[model samples]
Target: MPAAIALARQLSDADNKGIRLDSASLTEPGTPAEAFAVQRETLALNGWLTAGYKVAIRPDGSSVSAPMAHITHASTSGTAGFDRPAVDALEVEICFVLGKDLAPRNTPYTRETLLDHVAAIYSGVEFLGHRLDDGSRSPALLFLADRLGNAGYVLGEELPAKVTEPGQTYPLTITINGDAVFEGPGKHPNNDPVAAFLLFANALTEPVAKGRIITTGSLCGAIPTPPRAAIAISGFTTLTVTAASTRED
Candidate 1:
């Protein structure tokens, strides 16, 4: 097994108590498979609570290698802390709530069946481990064990649901401290992000509930959104969320 798993598990344990994990302990890294398993187990060890379903990571428009990217799993894990209802200086992003549980890969599913699980869609942000420079492994696996590297996801109201087709484009804009950092649409600089999500979403066996949101993935590679830094994922009428470091009361 990769040391990343053990370190991640241990770190995950500490984080659940509102303690942050240390990245330096991940000295002996493992393969993507190992890293992924550890992440799943870690989530189980802690408590997945009420969030699952994943978004796809498309090649950044500025990338040279078009990797066969995107991985899926339950969300809202990790050791990072943020405001629950909200923090003062939080990094916010838009998330999508799934209508139903998903079938595993290779299963036949249709737009109608998919929509039957109809639930309201909304947005939120996930604070996972960043700045660790654990950027050496495949994003799929690193994300797998880092407790999906997500923490304290928020959501939007369930009235005006966004029922996305398989190939539609999702426009995204991320801002920090009110300065626009990323602005784009589509996960595959070449393919559609909605298609990517559908591909994975359809594969899961169960449908997602009324409030489970998907952050999609980073429009920008990982960057730190600092104290009092507000991030807004500008899509679907724009979701305004924020994050900031606070002393535990």
Candidate 2:
């Protein structure tokens, strides 16, 4: 087993005290592929079930993905619970819920072909967390190995059919504790958020099951939040999240 995999298992172990690791202690992966392999091993060692994935796009247009475990689902009631206080970065994103299975194909899927599998679109938030002591400074490969700092996700209201059309941009407004913190237009880097879904779909070698949720990258970037903060986004859909202290039980 790779040293990184063992190190990741230790970081993800729920039974262990919240341990922080610097990059030196957990050696970085030599390549992107190696990092992804380490992620698979981490999930296996921790016995985490794949609930879905989170996709992030780089400046050069390449994308990286991390599988979200079942435990990462947060309440839609605008409140989220965390076990680690060190990792509380928040990201507002667009989420897609699949209605049907998209079986793996020999060739890549086109935008339209991929959209046909979607059941609904949602406004959502991704809670960022990582085991690395200095996760913010970690390299892309090391970050990917840590599941791209994804700790959990909160789903908002389902978007209207008209707004779900390809290439349409949605106005976004983010508020923390009733104060507007961010307001802007939101659109996937690919011009269509579903394109990111298709990219993820084509990359998979196995069929994606129905009802699997895929969250596209952040819109207003990752925002910091206070322990008792209440976050809300209004535009395509209204969504809210409240941050709570870490639970020991």
Taking all chains together, each candidate's TM-score versus the true structure is 0.59, 0.84
Candidate 2: tens digits of C-alpha lDDT, residues 1-249 = 557667567656621343456777667788877888877887888677777889766667676788876333445554444444434578777788889987889877887778788898777777776667666578778888888877767776666656546677778888988888888887655666665676778778677789888887777778876656777777766766666534222
lDDT, candidate 1, 1-249, per-residue tens: 546456656745554444443455544335545654565556555665545544554354211111111212223431222342212222333345555544454655565565455454444444543312342242444544554445445453332444243344556677777788766652422233344455545545444455455545443455555545565656543555545643232
Clashes in each model (backbone N, CA, C under 3 Å)? 20, 1
What C-alpha lDDT values do all the predictions have?
Answer: 0.45, 0.71
Q: Root-mean-square deviation of each candidate, in angstroms?
A: 7.9, 3.4
The lDDT, on a scale of 0 to 1, for candidate 1 is 0.45
Q: Model 1, poorest ten-residue lDDT window?
A: 62-71
Candidate 1 Cα misplacement greater than 4 A, ranges? 1-5, 13-33, 48-50, 57-81, 84-94, 103-107, 135-140, 157-174, 182-191, 202-211, 218-223, 232-236, 246-249
Find the candidate with the highest lDDT and give its number. 2
